[model samples]
Target: MDEVEVVVAHSQRATLRVGEVFLKVDVDPAHADVEVRAMAMVPVPTPAVLWCEPPVLAIAAVPGTALGVLGAPSPASPAAWAAAGAAIRRLHDAPLPPWPGRKLDDVAEELDRECAWLLANDVLPAEVVRRNREIAEAVLRPWTPAFIHGDLQITHVFVDDEDRVTGIIDWSEAAPGDAMFDLAILTLGHEEHLDDLLVGYGDADRDVIRAWWSLRSLTASHWLIEHGFDPDEPGCEFDVLRARMPDS
Candidate 1:
């Protein structure tokens, strides 16, 4: 049973809670609750089957509004970003079931489908869509996969007072693939706050992190182009992604 009533719809797949538990929809509402929440809770929040229409998904989750107001307001700040990075690291360290492939070539079909689906649905651009396909092929060729929050960026984080990360919401893209892919999103998403985050993380080379960011930069741009997203959107993560690219 859901802990709260759906007070209001905050986004396409997100909703506001009137009580403690937060209800969210990931993919395939009929799938096992465990698979739905494998991306969030550290020890598994234990989602259960319910008779509520649309499956009132029960999971331990945080509010998207709270996170957006605090965490995203200053993703470039040191204190703000460090907390964000650490939260991400903790998430990356979490165990997940392995998927079929680690090599870019292996997941090429899936990646292509994602890009294609977005494009076909009028969420991506024609010319730029091709770029996303090419980028996926290139990046996955020699990829070392780990658990990745495949759709991370500014909109995913939630922070508390004093600018500490309170929660990292949005697990729709969660998958056991490349850890670097997640790092790349975190790095590019919080470039302004990179220093603050790394201070606690120390001066680790973290090449994979760098690679993930650079590659995602290119791929994300393709997404933007396909979707006709303004390149100059204020504080938009896509601009950061482009700025961080070495070749760009």
Candidate 2:
């Protein structure tokens, strides 16, 4: 029997790796449904769906290693980052997902709610949170939707030794939404590589990308903390929020 290694365990879901198979067990069957369908629709390389039984979805492991880890310098080459950008462009150009993602108004409302929670709990300095909220306003406007990987973190993208993107994982949040949201999430903590990623992605609104940095960091901190992860790591979520301060 293969050893079942726990990849992540949280209230909403848990992921386990048993040899070359990754099993994702989600509390929401809808999430599993979305992931399975999104993987099929995406033109880029993705893990093969082996099977799905209710809460558990089994997928073949992707080849190569992740492009980078959150809050850490990416060891991947510039070519790899460009490849990731090109892959994202392909996804965005694909047909819209069957379902829609959060509306801009909904995102703004959630940001407001989360910001209030952050302030009430003192998770972040009030001024820091406030300033970022102001900056985040830039992303609240209507966007021509695209197929977006709602959680396009650096760790989600896998690259080959030759600096080519082999696959991208975690499609639960995949839906039709702002393309810049994916771009912003991919470059979250690794702002220095924005230019390289943009070279392949082509034109993008830099301001909106920056806004998403703040919006994502603000909304994700509480969830991360609840899920047994620290958002305050030097270059992690909280730091991403702090980095937006005018004089940080």
Candidate 3:
């Protein structure tokens, strides 16, 4: 018998791997339904759903390893990054998902709350939080929505040895949102590959994408720490936030 391995364990969710099968345990039962439905709708490659039992969904793991991880150099070739970009393009070009994405007002309110928390908790210097928060505002405005993989982080994408995309996983957050948001999330903490990814994804609002880098780092750092992941690594989320400051 293959030993079960913990893929990820957080308060809201956990994933366990047993050989070729991955079991996703979500706190919210509705998320499982959305993930099952969204995976069916996406044109790109995704893990095959084997079965679902309320809070737990079992899926066949995809063939390839992750394209990369946040805060680490990607072993994947530039071509792999380009392939990921192309995959994202395919997703955004597809028809909108049945559900709507987050409202701008809600996002702004959350940002304000997170910023206050950061300062009050001394997680980051007040000036650092303030400057990045200002930069983040650029992407907090209205925009035409597209089919976005709401949590399109690099770790969620997988690729073969030849730099070909094999599949994408973690679909619970999939929804309609800003196209750039997906691109920004994919390239977060890995800006060096932006040029490669953009080659396949095509031109975009560079400023907005950069702004989201700041926004993503600012909003996600606290939660990551709470979940037992360090955001203060040399090239991780905290570094990303400080990168946006004027004198960095």
- The best candidate in terms of lDDT: 2
Q: Return the lDDT, model 2, position 36.
A: 92
* Residue 21 accuracy (lDDT) in model 3: 97
Question: RMSD in angstroms, all models?
Answer: 6.2, 0.9, 0.9
Worst 10 residues of 2 by lDDT: 100-109
- Candidate 1: clashing pairs of residues: 67-158, 82-197, 104-140, 124-226, 124-227, 125-226, 145-177, 146-177, 146-178, 184-213
Worst 10 residues of 1 by lDDT: 43-52
- Model 2 TM-score on a 0 to 1 scale: 0.98
Give the per-residue lDDT digits (tens) of candidate 2, residues 182-246.
99999999999999998888999999999999999999988888888999987899999888888
What's each prediction's TM-score? 0.58, 0.98, 0.98
Candidate lDDT scores, in order, read 0.51, 0.93, 0.91
Evaluation by lDDT, superior candidate among 2 and 3: 2
lDDT of 1 by residue, 1-248 (tens): 54557643422344545466555553456332434555434532222323233545654555322323212454235666666666666666677644442456545555665556656765434555454344434345454445566656665676656766655555545666766565556556445555666664454335555545435544454455555555346545444434443455
Check candidate 3 and list the clashing pairs. none
Please write out the lDDT profile of model 3 over residues 33-150, one tens digit for every residue. 8899999999899999999998899999898889788878988889999999888899999999989789999889889988989999999999999999999999988999888888
Ranking of predictions according to TM-score: 2, 3, 1
Q: Candidate 3: lDDT of 152?
A: 90
Candidate 1 segments whose C-alpha is farther than 4 A from its true place: 1-27, 30-35, 39-77, 98-103, 106-138, 141-144, 202-211, 217-248
